[model samples]
Target: MTRLRIVLADDHPLVLMGMRDLLEKDFSFEVTATLDSPTALVEHLRRHPAHVIITDYSMPGDETYGDGIRLVKYLRRHFPVPRVVVLTMVSNPMIISALYDAGVSAVVLKRHNLNEISAALHTLQAGRRYYPPGFQRDGAIDARNKFIGERINSLSPKEYEVLRHFVRGESMMQVAESLKRSIKTVSGQKISAMRKLNVQTDQELVAFCVTSGIFP
Candidate 1:
């Protein structure tokens, strides 16, 4: 059989070239194109479709959109959607679950190396769903503003981890333990974070995370 066609989209040039070299060397994949923007990737797809698209979630863009999540959704909606594999530093539950719901084929935390990408691609090619195990853990919520307009940061890296765990049915103690922190510390952080975000409870925080793209 012919090798599967693939494309890469990430703002990091070195990372993009490195991943391309790895995939082309190790797999039955033929990289058709590489791009730095989701918009450009979309335009390329209209001309020549690929079997898979490996995109970075944190790709830099104008103030309008930051991650490639929106691009994933667009592809899923357009006719002849290609299988998508999102590579991101973010492993938050809100984002992962939403991408899954949007028909993303795989979600891999970018911390994984070229070997992991090969494994993910192989698994998907074999007709199985792939989600990097242990995506979210009991994490704390950071309320420092991200400086993106008037929006408060809402969640720090650690806090986002806490938010993901709490939203996924974990409790305060469970979250603290998973995060290797004290219960009181986690509790205080959550409460303070909620206050800053103007949210009163865990459920509300979860809802906000999904809607505001704060953690997701």
Candidate 2:
């Protein structure tokens, strides 16, 4: 039998090491690479192929391929062969839905046993999407999550950047400077994001971001 080729990427060194050990212990899985950043993963994929790619949702410090939905989209666009599984601590239904929409094959919450990673890979082998337990508990919850997910997805890339900066405690001027946009433009983007998210104040926007796990 052929072993499943796997690539693991995570920002945390300990988490990456743990995942490598867990997957390697399984005789059917082969970890071809363990990367710590989005850039490294992309570079590795350019030269090596894998059957599965399990990665964290947020691996900050890679400006070329910013984390979250952005990184997922990039991987799907550039390397569509490997199945992508997101292993993250983020539990916000809105973000989870967004990740699925971005074309990941599975999402396993880190709070669960790491063994779920193997289960996720098996589900992918069967050509099915895997969701964490209780991810689709009821119609009412799905409806609410769908509504918020739509709102969150409506933000343009620039608008999302504005919110990410704000959540990181950056001032409006700081964000504007960093993005090379005028203060007015940055503020406008912030307002637009707030409107889409139905947040009325800066505090509310930050609170929503934190609770939604958009930055985490």
Give RMSD to native, each candidate.
12.7, 4.4
Which lDDT tens digits does candidate 2 get at residues 1-216?
567899999989999999998888889899999999999999999999898899998676676777777788899999999989998876666667878998999999998999999898878877799999888564445777777767776787668767877787778897776566799999999999999999999989988888776765
**Model 2 lDDT at residue 148:** 74
Model 2 lDDT, residue 44, Cα: 98
Point out where model 1 deviates above 4 Å: 62-66, 136-216
Candidate of highest TM-score: 2
lDDT of all the models against the reference? 0.71, 0.84
Query: Candidate 1, residue 19: CA error in Å?
Result: 0.5
lDDT of 1 at 77: 79
Window of ten residues with lowest summed lDDT in model 2: 136-145
Top candidate, metric lDDT: 2
Query: Which parts of model 2 are misplaced by more than 4 Å?
Result: 138-162, 170-189, 192-200, 207-216
What residue pairs clash in candidate 2, if any at all? none
lDDT of each residue in 1-216, candidate 1, tens digit only: 457799899888998899899888965988999998877787788899788888887654322333444556677777255788888866556657777887888888876666788888888889887888675454344544333212334344445555655765678987676566799988877777677677876678888767765544
